[model samples]
Target chain A: MDFQTILILAQDAITNSAIYALLALALILVFGVTRVIFVAQGEFVSYGALTLASLQTGVMPGTVWLLLILAFIAACMETARLLVSGARHKLPGALATILAPPLAIAALVKICTPLHLHLGWQLILTMLIVIPLGPLIYRVAFRPLADATVLVLLIAAVAVHFVLVGLGLLFFGAEGVRTPPFSDAQFTFANLNVSGQSLCVYATTIVFVAIMAWFFNKTLYGKALRAVAFNRNGARLVGITPHLAGTFSFALASAIGCLSGLLIGPITTLYYDSGFLIGLKGFVGAIVGGMASYPIAAAGALMVGFSESFSSFWLSGYKDVVVFTMIIPVLLWRSLTTAHYEEEE
Target chain B: MKQFLASISMLAVLAAGTAAQADITIGVNLSSTGPAASLGIAEKNAISFGPSVIAGQKVHYVIYDDATDTTTAVQNVKRLVSENKVDVLIGPTTSPTSAAVIEAVAASKTPMIQLSPGPATISATDEKRKWIFSAPANTTIYGTAMINHMVKKGVKTVSVIAVDDAYGEVSTAAYKTLSEPKGIKTLTIEKYKRTDTSATAQVLHAMQGNPDAIFIASSGTPAALPHVALIERGYKGKIYQSGGAANAEFLRVGGKALEGSFMLAPPVVVGEQLPDGYPTKAEALKFIKAYEAKFGPRSMFASLAWDALKIVEAAVPKALKKGKPGSEKFRVALRDAIEGTKGLKGAGSVFSMSATDHSGVNQLGMSLMKVENGKWKLEDHAEFK
Candidate 1:
């Protein structure tokens, strides 16, 4: 490849790496705090992008109904748990928190749809509709099995992924949709032209990463989540509820996944089931981090993006096989370098 | 007269006491919820307009969503054959699933009206295709039309990128086979997964050759990715799509970037623009009118499904006279009747099925179309043969 082509392909890989980095961080974050593999984490990306597409077209997004339905189920589960535990006093507040966001968002979507709200409002609305789904998923599917083995939780996560995929098809229909780019402007540097959408992705990724760094190091809930990540029983002894930590981390993960979707939506067409492969690539990056370090995971995702970009160029037919096969070596190094510990369960 | 004939067949078909013969069941397996849903959903939606009663006996369609997975498609085919006792099978849409279910259908001796990518070259000696007939134009017809078009335009070098599946593999092969003999040198051939979110590497690789033209051999909206990416990079050469992106959605998805690109759509899609002497024009106009009247917008895939049933409808009466509807003999008769199809009007093509040619559509079945201002405009009424 010539210098210009190399530069262009690198640009493409970097744009992809930005999104994969977010996904890796989300995967790592969820796995750390919840001990759940969080396989359905990618579904949120489809949901976020699709919901925005629907909203942009001035129609009520299917996410509104999905959110309400899931919210109702979450409310019932939380209500049932509270009654069983004799925490009846906490029931009203818990129910309000569980049920209100989806209902309010549904109402907002219904109200604002015909108004043909601008893209900014629509994006915020999209986030509002999809973000709560994270915690709600935790409540309905994961929280009930909180004490279960990681394998069981992993299976549940996969099942949830399939269910979400089916639901995505129902809501979004079979045809994929692409949103207009955030900005259509082009930038050129040293004979290399870059798209505005790529810039948007880069800016958003950096800002989100910085915010995540700050949240983990500075905020109380973030510290609680970190404490929970470090030691569940130890944090519980100090009055940190692992349940809250799990929900918080899922929320963060979903937010990251949703943003990744938004970032990548304009760049390509995302089908109902596109997120799994994207998320799997991120998981490969997480493996690069040895599932422990955020910085290494992000860098690994860049490596994956570069390899994927270059390999597809060199050997287009075997790109996926090449990209997925990357996990083997990182896994080998991981197994060889890390000291094995007794089973956590 | 129709009612009288129907009543006669219904009465004759119902012999309750001994292995009671009943409805002419057509088992449909489609990928309505997965990657191939673009093709499957349209076909599924068009099922509502299918003829309910053929030759005076009720036609029962046992539709199942195979979710675009081959295993699920095979299972559905089994259930449709053994459980439903279908007289014929309509789908297992998408090429891989269609190819996968061929063995099962051949085993059960049920005739299928294949709806996805027609194989590039069906060997006349192949026994498996005996019970199978396709609804759409095959890869050879598409590849030939595209190659001939490129040849007409004096294009000497080309690149091809297709989905890394049964359809793409065959189309890429067809391009190389057809284009090379036509004096066009293929610079590169690339493949990407159908469910892939991006085609950066494939696009970059394809562009590296800087060939005179690029042929994207994928179907549906996914085809738009490389097109859009190519446009983004300001690659100003001609881009061609196969018949797979005939739907309006491909145009919508790709939007402004797709303008001026060429695609080979079945002549039915551009029926109004076709010359009156064309065989499929009248039926094409009728299907477009009827389908759009119900569904609002016209769809190419939907018309493919409609045309499959048209062939089935034409064959049923002749097949009905031979044996009872549920009998294996009736399926055999149906298969024979379908194979005997000659000069029959369909939405996609005037099918002329025979012993050797299952999807008996020639180059005339497809027309060269281009995206002009985000809509499919007929470029050449391709009668290349």
Candidate 2:
């Protein structure tokens, strides 16, 4: 490859990797802390997009910033209510608790018609609503199932997926809901042409990811959540209630997914079914990083993103067949290497 | 002895005359679900319209649902012929299933009148295959006519995005043949399956090439509007929608986004003056008025079905009178009536089908329309010169 071409492709890969990284990392976060594989995580991404689009447009007008804040607040509140209610009379720890967040969102959306939302507003609303989703789902569904086997929680995740899809179709008709375009402005750097909205997406993902990393490393609650992810029972023994920290982890993870949703709308049009593909792609990213490590997961996402961009550039027609085919072999190699790593440890 | 012999002779003549009538059965396989439900529904309704059109004919109808699958289509054709004993068969809406049905019906030596975009399986070259017929323009005709229009508009560079099935592949092939020599350069070409929702990446690839025009080949709702996002991205390039998006529903969903967008399709009534004393035009307006009154004013497919029904109606009576029910003579008469039709007016267009061409509307009358006032309004009618 030419040096300039390589450089440009690398930049494009980095951008692609970052978007995938955010979604993958968020998915892993919910799983790592709550031990519940939340399948509805993808739906939250779509919900975030639709929400933001609705709020920013005069279709459901308020100040952009205000709408974002309100959407975020509403997301967290909804999560809390769902988790609390789902756990009310159930067995203290069951898989059902881990799925409550998605269930709640589905119910909420099912009850209300999708607002005719603009693309920008959709981005904002979806992002705002996603911040608290992970925790809410974890608190209700996974917390009760925290002590349950991984397979059991996996089954619960599948259930969450069904509910999310069913509700998405039931509420938003099984067709594309178009969002109007953002303003047109382009910035060229070197050989790459970047649009104004795309730059915002890149910047937002970075800022959000950085702030999250900082919060995890520095804050008391974030530290508690990390501790729980490290050793759940141990954290409980040390005076941290795993239940609350688990919820927080889920919320934070879901918020990241929401961020991915908001960022995607301007660059790509979205529909209810669009979430499943991205979600599956994120899963690939998470598995590439070994699924247990955030930094590594992000690295894997970057690698996948770069490879995709590279394939698209060099072998455009076979991009899909090339990218998807790589997944099986990469996964096998990763698993084999991780086994070796564990043996060494 | 003489009287007895005369009576015996009279009884034998009467018995032989009574044995001459043979019953003919026609099988119709159509979709009841999936994206083409409305089209299938109208066509199925047209089956009923057949009896009404021929007020005195009693032809047996055998209808089955293909359910929009190829395997099911093949199965249904066999069922209709072997079990239902149909002498003739029609339909299976889309190209893929239509192709399967055509092959099966041809193999069984049963005459079939398929409703499809003739490109998927049976081609004009394959017309010698005998016992097969199409009631729509082959992809070659559509692609050639559409290319001719583009060439007329001075569009020399074109980009194509379409579903990656027989219809898209064939249409693209035709476009390349007709446009390349005319100095039309195809910059970006992409294909997606009918089920794909994410056209962003593919469309983005197409936009990168920066062609003067884009041709979206897929007629399904999913493929229709993703280009709108490309338009939003500040691309002012002309978009030539295929014959598929010419439907009113597609326009309604695309709304203001589709304003001034052009299409290549058969003519539909959009504020055109009716010819005096044309029965089809009056019937179409009445049906439209009734449908709008009952179904909230967006009844576009109703008229097309009504026309198809009228075709069946006009054929049935003449066929019934020409031969007894189920007779070869009766079936042949029906075919002649359908094929010989000319200048028969309907709600959408004045239609005529000939033995050489099953498509009622011709390249001579392709309807060109533009999105105006949030609805599809006919801009002009073009005849191949």
What would the per-residue lDDT of candidate 2 be over residues A1-345, giving only the tens digit for each residue? Answer: 456556655665666677778888787887777776666777766666655544543233222222233334545554566587786444333434443444554444333325544454445445544565455455445656778887899998888677656655544434444444355687777765666766766787778778878988999887888888778778888999877776676777667767776666555445566677667667778877766877778777877777776765545556657657768987789767765532110
Question: For residues B25-141, could you state the per-residue lDDT of candidate 2 as single tens digits?
Answer: 668888755546667766675555444213443356788887777898899999987777665677777667876766677666555666665634543345433455555556666
- Predicted candidate 1 versus true structure: per-residue lDDT over A1-345, tens digit per residue: 888888888988999888889999999999999889988878888888888888888878887888999999888888898999999999999999888878888998899988887788888888888988888889889988988988999999999999999899888887888987888898999998888989999999899889989999999888988988888888899999999899888898889888888889899998788898888888888889977799999999999999988988899888988998888888898899999986565
C-alpha positional error of residue B383 in candidate 1 after TM-score superposition, expressed in Å: 3.1
Residue A232 of model 2 has an lDDT of: 79
Worst 10 residues of 2 chain A by lDDT: A58-67
Task: Place model 2 in a CAPRI quality band.
Answer: incorrect
Q: How far in Å is the alpha carbon of B268 misplaced in model 2?
A: 1.1
> Interface RMSD for candidate number 1?
1.7
TM-score of each: 0.90, 0.72
CA-lDDT, candidates in order: 0.85, 0.63
